[model samples]
Target: MNSEKLLAILKLQATKNVGDIIAKKLIAATGDVEQVFKESKNTLHKINGIGTHVTDSLFANENLKRAEEELHYIQQKNIGFSYFLEDDYPQNLKHCIDAPILFFKEGNIDLSNQKIISVVGTRNITSYGRDFCNQLIEDLKDYNPIIVSGFAYGVDICAHKAAIKNNLQTTGVLAHGFETIYPKTHKKYISEVHKNGGFITEFWHDEQPMRENFLKRNRIVAGLSKATIIIESAKKGGSLVTADIANSYNRDVFALSGRANDIYSTGCNNLIKNNQAHLLSSADDIVKMLNWDLSKTSPPKQKELFVSLTDIEQKVYDYLQQNGKQLLDVIALNCDIPVYKLSSILIQMELKGVVKPLPGKLFEI
Candidate 1:
């Protein structure tokens, strides 16, 4: 984007009471970001959601000053950014109504790979959660997914590390600006994260990682991916907030199931029990749900010859082979297996390379 347009976006972003949704409306009404500032106060006020206070903020001289300062910093540091309307912006995030009009990024981040999933959980991650997270990324390496997370403690950093170890690109969504890294200890991982993928944030260059920024950051993490996975979370935590946001976008959400009494498991278990998320037992569940395996030009039917299946698995395979793709509920009813039991059985068959999952809960041999 040109300097004038960038400054206009920054000014709009700096305006108090003018959020992404409102900024977008102003831009849409005026036909351009720069035009929003050029338009008269009366014209802006005529737009819905633009009241006197909003128009006043939009014209605030202090906002333009701040925008100029930020623009200078961006130019000096050679920072990268993606405007909402630009082709470079993340496609998944573009669909979110409240996504930032512009977001800053750093490192060798690539959005071309569509096999993206965000994994988040509690800051106090358990050993079970950690191991599951590691193995999950390892299993998914073949698919070369872009693993995204908040770059915070526990499950977030764990997922990033695992993705790097598996030689996969992992993007960290930051709650603060590029000027400072939150949780000083994570500074060591920043270089490695940059090498593997990079960091992205909607906050300005010097913005602090305030408490409220995390809530805003969660949406970007959830928005950047095709699905959101909660490895572990308490009954109330930020990861659940991401899950909620992902759900609001009508994206798939998978929650790792743990023992009911486990503290961190409470949130994920609740999500699954409430039908708000799928019961994720393994990476196969994600592979199936996202239909990542369908991209194969010639799926390896040879693996089936060497694979072994339980009687129930064999039954499901036979049914799917005869019926083509079938919904989870339909397969459960026709095969005399309860839906709950069939879900896990299908996942196992998926791991054994006997069946493939399609979108909308459909499955095929």
Candidate 2:
């Protein structure tokens, strides 16, 4: 984007009481972000939701000054950024109602048609949570998913480490700016994270890691991914808020259940009990829920079609073989397997050439 248009977006972000939603409305009404600034106060006020208070903040001298300072820092440091309207903006985040209009990024980041998922949980991660997070990413490695997390202590860092170990791209969404790293100890992981993936933050260069900033950052974590998984959380925590944001975006959410007495499991259990999230058991849950590619090792072979099958796969194959083509739901019901597991089983059967998938989710032998 041109410098002129970039400055306008920063100024809008720096403006008080003018959030992403209102900024978007203003942009839509004005036809462009640059045009929003060129319009007179009276003209801008005529637009819906752009009242005196917002207009006053929109043109405030101080806001412009801050924007200019941030722009200068960005230019000096050669920072990379993505405006919401740009082609490089995250596809999943673009659909969010309150996603940042502009955000700075650093490191080798790529979002091109990638399978992404955010794994979040309590900072006080338990042995159980850590093991589960590790195994989950290990299993998902075959699918080559990009793991996203806060890069904080406990579950966040655990998720990042697991992803790195699996050689999958990982993104750490920061609460503060690039100028500083929170939890000073994390400074060591920065280089490794950048090499593997990168860091992203909506804050300007010098912004501090305030309490509220973390809350605001959760939206990005939730928005950037196809689904958000909570490994563990207290009854009240930022991860749960992320799950809520993901749900609001009409994205699927999964929560790992734990013993009732475990402190960190409270939030995840509550989410599942309330039907806010799917009950996540193993990696299969996500594999099935997201309908990710099940043939992880190789493409289906063209050999003569004879292959062995598990009892469940046999039931599905026999049903299809006898019944001709059938809808996925019908097969699931007749085979007495839930649609979630049935989907994966069918994919395996297809890879073995025991069944063929047809258009509109139908299957046949």
Candidate 3:
């Protein structure tokens, strides 16, 4: 893009009170990003959602000066970037209403004909979470999906490392600018990450990794993928926020279930219980739900068709077979079993291949 257009986008990005949605509105109203500045305050005010405060911020001289300085920095460094309206921008993120209007990227990152998913979770990852994250990435390597994450501790870095070990591309979404790396120790992995995939961020060259920036970074992680997976999470954390954002974008979400008493598992269990995410037990669940091509890769082994079933399992299996598909609550009611007991029974049946779990607490024979 030309310096003028790039400067205009930077100014719009720097403008206070003007978010991605508002910036897009201004661009649409003027019919061109550069033209937005050319239009008079009166003309710009005619656009819906463009109030006096927004107009004031848009025309602020400070914003222009900052944009010019950043533009020069970008030009001198020969940095790469993608505009929301451009074809090179991530297609999945382009559909998000709150996606950044412009963002910077680095390395051999390529999204063309790629299957992407974001793996995220609590920074305090347990042994189980780490094992599952590694196994999940290794198993999915054959499909060659681009793994996306925040590049923070625990699950994020674990996902990135697994992808690297498996020779799969991995993208790190950052909260700070390219001028500095957060968690300074992660600086060691930068060269390797760039070699395999790379990093992306909306923050300017000098921006710091503020508290709110991490929350903002979560959106990019969620928006760039076809699905978001929470390997593990606390009762409340940024990973859950990303899952919510993915759901808002109408993307598939999967949560790994853990023991109910485990503190880290509480968030994931709640998501499954509330029907906010699919109960992820294995890689097969993702492949099946996403309808990925099983012929191209070695599929996971299925349970024996003639496996024995317990008396309760037989009763639930027969109920599911007769009903076709039923909700967990409904299944418990109809089978004359309590929900707590029925959950375990259903899980056993699922392992036996006599029952399958679907979205929304649904089960099928």
Candidate 4:
């Protein structure tokens, strides 16, 4: 984008009371970010959701000054950024109603890959959560998914490191600005993260990491992916907030189930019990639910020679062979297997070259 347009976007972003939704409304009404300023206050007021306070803030002298300063810093540092309407902007995030109009980024980040998933959880991660996060990424490496996390301690950092170890792209969404790293201890991982993926933030270069900022950051994490996985979370925490945002966006949410009595598992258990999130058991659950394996466009191969199958797997394979092709739910009903268990079984069968998934969740042997 040109300096003039970026400056206008920054100015609009700096305007108080004009958040992403209101800013977008203003932009749409005026037909351009710059036009928002050119239009008279009376004209802006006529736009729905536009009130006196928003119009008043739109032209604030301080906003323009701050915009100018940030714009200069952006130019001097040669920073990377994407406007909401730009093609380079995250595709999944673009669908969100309240997504930021612009967000700054650093490193070799790529969003063209649609197989993205955000994994979040408590900062005080247990060994079990850590092990699960590691194994999940390892199993998903072949699918080449872009792992996303908050870049905090515990589960967040664990997910990023696991992604890096598995040689998959991993993005760290930051609550603060690029100028400062939050935990200071995480600074060492910055170079590796940049080498593998990068970092994204909606905050300006000098914005501090505040309590409220973390809450606001959760939405971006939830918005940028097709699914959000809560590896662990307390009854009240930011990860749960991300889950809520993801659900609101109509995105798939999976929570790692733990014992009911476990403190950190309470939030995930509640989410599962309340029907807010699916119970996440293994990587196959995600692979099946998200249809990641359905990307195979080639013709379905016959079952591998001399391949061994468990009794249940054999039952499912026999049913599919006899029925030709059938919907997942239908196959589950006929085979007397629960949908959840059937999903995992189908994935296992697919990996063994016994069956392939068609569009609309149909499977054939």
Instruction: Give lDDT per model, in order.
Output: 0.90, 0.89, 0.89, 0.90
Candidate 3, run of 10 with poorest lDDT:
296-305
TM-score of each: 0.81, 0.80, 0.81, 0.81
Ranking by lDDT: 4, 1, 3, 2
Q: Can you give the lDDT of residue 44 in candidate 1?
A: 88
Question: Which window of 10 residues has the lowest lDDT sum in candidate 2?
Answer: 296-305
Q: What lDDT score is found at residue 293 in candidate 4? A: 76
Candidate 3: residue 41 lDDT (0-100): 95
RMSD of each candidate? 14.9, 15.8, 15.5, 15.0
What stretches of model 4 exceed 4 Å from their correct place? 294-365
Candidate 1 wrongly placed segments (more than 4 Å): 294-365
Residue 63 local lDDT, model 2: 89
The Cα error of candidate 1 at residue 320, in Å, is 49
The TM-score between candidate 3 and the true structure equals: 0.81
lDDT of 2 by residue, 29-123 (tens): 99999898899999998987788999988888898899999999999998999989989999999999899998999999997655899999999
Residue range 142-194, candidate 1, lDDT tens digits = 78889999999999988988887667899999999999888897886787789
